[model samples]
Target: MQRANAELVRSLGAVRVIDYTKEDFSASGHTYDVIVDTVGTAPFKRSRGSLGRGGRLLLVLATLWQMLLAPWESAVSGKKVVAGPASERVEDLRFLAKLAQEGSLKPVIDRRYTLEQIAEAHRYVETGRKRGSVVVMVSHG
Candidate 1:
């Protein structure tokens, strides 16, 4: 984890944050209830071994092939591989807003850009090294 992002994640009550630059988390022989793949570099096939029983692998940046195979893999295994476009629901948004208001949920912003820099933000996100969310500021002026 990047030093800047690590502080945010820690503040959010993450028990531990592995630094991928210095260590391989998968090779540590530890299993987790939830594994979120943000970079899309983790191996889906081998990830099954990393999940505990009834665990979930949330693929935020899955490839097309990974997305296609997720359902089939879930059907045959106890673990679940979740990947796809997300649907926005009012209830979920409300809950998130509540959390944010309570200071329990703070989004980690890796970079910020104005509306005019949207293309540049897209390119940065595409690089897959962004530690957290990219903010695109919309000026009312």
Candidate 2:
């Protein structure tokens, strides 16, 4: 992760933020019960050694092959690979909204652009250096 983003997550109570550019967290001799790979950079093979027994690897952006191999991997290793779309139930969304409204949930927004600048926004995001959510403003209000 970028340095600024690392600090942002730290401020949000992240126990530790591994800057992959400088460190290889998996080789650090630490084990975790759950590792969430939001960007799909950490694949099952690369992360298997870092997981404790019965640990879960949640792949938010899994490839088709990874999804297909998840069950077999889990069966053999006792570590689970969960790869799929996220649940977007209304109640869950409402709960998140409530948390945000109550100031209990803080979202990191790295940048905002007007609707007209959407193409530029996409270009920037494609660079893969963005630290947090990039908002596209549809209206002034």
Candidate 3:
């Protein structure tokens, strides 16, 4: 697990950052109120079991099957699946930015590459092993 990711999660009130590479969260016998699967590494079917009653699974990168099933599942089950693109609201964006500025929210920056090394950044992101955002340093001057 990336230290930045672990720290960021911890900073945002995470009791624990389960390293999925080391341990299987679903098999740990602990259910969660909300599970945010950003990488789409854990499929919705396997992860639904990890949610408590009336819990939510927020998928940032969902599979076609999961996307198709989300609406139907929400209508029929207590566990809700929230997937797809988020609404782009100016107020929401500014609120989040302000939180970051105030140190209330800290982004986990996995790696930084110069503008000259943008391709390297893309390659790293494509690997999908990045714990957080891969920053490309662009010089505006």
Per-model CA lDDT versus the true structure:
0.85, 0.90, 0.85
Compose the digit string of candidate 3's lDDT tens values, residues 18-122: 988799998999999989888787666778788999999899898778888898887787889988777899999999999989988777788999999999899
Is 1 or 2 the stronger prediction by lDDT? Answer: 2
Q: Give the TM-score of candidate 2.
A: 0.86
In terms of TM-score, which candidate is strongest?
2
> Which should have the higher lDDT, number 2 or number 3?
2
Candidate numbers sorted by TM-score from highest down? 2, 1, 3
Tell me each candidate's RMSD, in Å, in order: 2.3, 2.1, 2.4
Candidate 1, poorest ten consecutive residues by summed lDDT? 38-47
After superposition on all CA atoms, how large is the RMSD of candidate 3?
A: 2.4
- Best candidate (score: lDDT): 2
**TM-score for candidate 1, residues paired by index:** 0.82
Residue 90 error, candidate 3, Å: 1.5
Q: Whole-model lDDT, candidate 2?
A: 0.90
